[model samples]
Target chain A: MPTIVVDVMPKAELLDPQGKAVTGALSRLGVDAFSAVRIGKRFELTVEGEVDDDVLATARRIADEILSNAVIEDVVAVEVVE
Target chain B: MPTIVVDVMPKAELLDPQGKAVTGALSRLGVDAFSAVRIGKRFELTVEGEVDDDVLATARRIADEILSNAVIEDVVAVEVVE
Candidate 1:
């Protein structure tokens, strides 16, 4: 089976309060070297078919429609793992 | 070069309100097929060294110490992409 992982993050236009909160917490936790945090959704999907163009296309469409808030966020990437 | 991705999720014990909110929105958006949402942190790191056992180990330690909240969450996986 091929696993498809989607990472959805807030668009640059929107203020990511959640990410900002996490980033502040991380700073206190000693990850102070990195200054910002961008929180996103990661979906791990196990599809029961060969990983091909068609499957990838379907996954991309799904990501655009249901997995992401296109108005405020974007799908960063869709990765395939076997 | 190889990229290392880390997935950090809340421990089963902690309540994931963000995930719950997302799940609710997904259901409203017609993904009624699934019922829950689980949010996690995905880090994409481009490392300087070759992707080997030593690198992976170092990466794992980093995840445990800095990337993940060991007190409440866990590092589910560390994936290497070439």
Candidate 2:
């Protein structure tokens, strides 16, 4: 099985309220060694059969078109992992 | 900088409505080669300075206690990436 992982996060320039909120909670919970916290969507897709360039392309297309909003967010990384 | 990526997913026995919805949308949009679709969370945390075992442990603790629900979900993977 081929697993496609799409990690989506807000653009670096934009302020992430969710991340900030999490950071605040982390501080309250006492794990504040983090300089920054980024919260985003990580969509994992498992494709049946062989994993190839076409699958990679489809994953990219889905990540770009369906997964993350290109305007304010960026699909920072997309890859196939074992 | 050390970045810890935590991938959280629902237990295999659990039903994932979000994943199913996405699968349905994919079927409608025409890209359905998936045997099973599971939706979960990926948390990206940035710790200041060096990334090490302590960081990894903290990441695990956070993933287990903070990011995911122990009852229904599982932290499938955790790693420190460059």
Candidate 3:
């Protein structure tokens, strides 16, 4: 089955404290080169039926309506392997 | 150009508090069906050179070495829309 992954972020456009904390930890771990780190989310969904354009459309609609808060956050799709 | 997205999570197999917070908010937002929501990260990295197999290999190496905490977190590569 093809999994549908969703990455949702806060819409307020403010600095993500959680992300910063993680990034700080990473910097301590010796990855200090990157300037900033923004944390979001990852959702893997298993589509029961076929993987088609219609499914994608429905998924996009759902993302817009319920999965993501467009005003404060952004949603991106991560493709599944197999 | 293609973007390389990295999702890093906690490694120790414990409950993710940040994820739980987001899930609670999502449930309040009327998405009560999905039992849980685990928050990770979404990183958009622009590969400076080329989008080739070698680059992917290097990126995966970097993910393993610095980006993801293999002990507790899982790393998944999301394809970029180019």
True contacts kept of each: 0.14, 0.68, 0.28
Tens-digit per-residue lDDT, B1-51, candidate 2: 778888888888888888888878887888876555667776778889888
Worst 10 residues of 3 chain B by lDDT: B31-40
lDDT of 1 by residue, A14-75 (tens): 78887677567665766433344555667755566576787677668878987777999899
Choose 1 or 3, whichever is better by lDDT.
Answer: 1
User: Model 2 segments beyond 4 Å from truth?
Assistant: none
Every candidate's CA RMSD: 5.3, 1.7, 5.3
Q: TM-score for model 1?
A: 0.61
Candidate 1 C-alpha lDDT tens digits along B1-82:
4677778878868888877776677657665433444667776555555677876776687689867879988898888877
Candidate 3, residue B78: the lDDT equals 42
Model 3 per-residue lDDT at B51: 62
> Which one wins on lDDT?
2
For candidate 3, the C-alpha RMSD (Å) to the true structure equals 5.3
Model 3, A15-80: lDDT tens digits are 778667756765687643344555566664456556677666655665777667787678766454
Give the TM-score of chain A in candidate 3.
0.76
RMSD of 2: 1.7
**Which pairs clash in model 2?**
none
Ranking by DockQ: 2, 3, 1
Candidate 3 clashing pairs, residues 3+ apart or interchain: A10-A72, A11-A72, A11-A73, B11-B72, B11-B73
lDDT by residue for model 2 over A18-81, one digit each (tens)?
8888889999988976777777777778888888888788888988997779999899788876
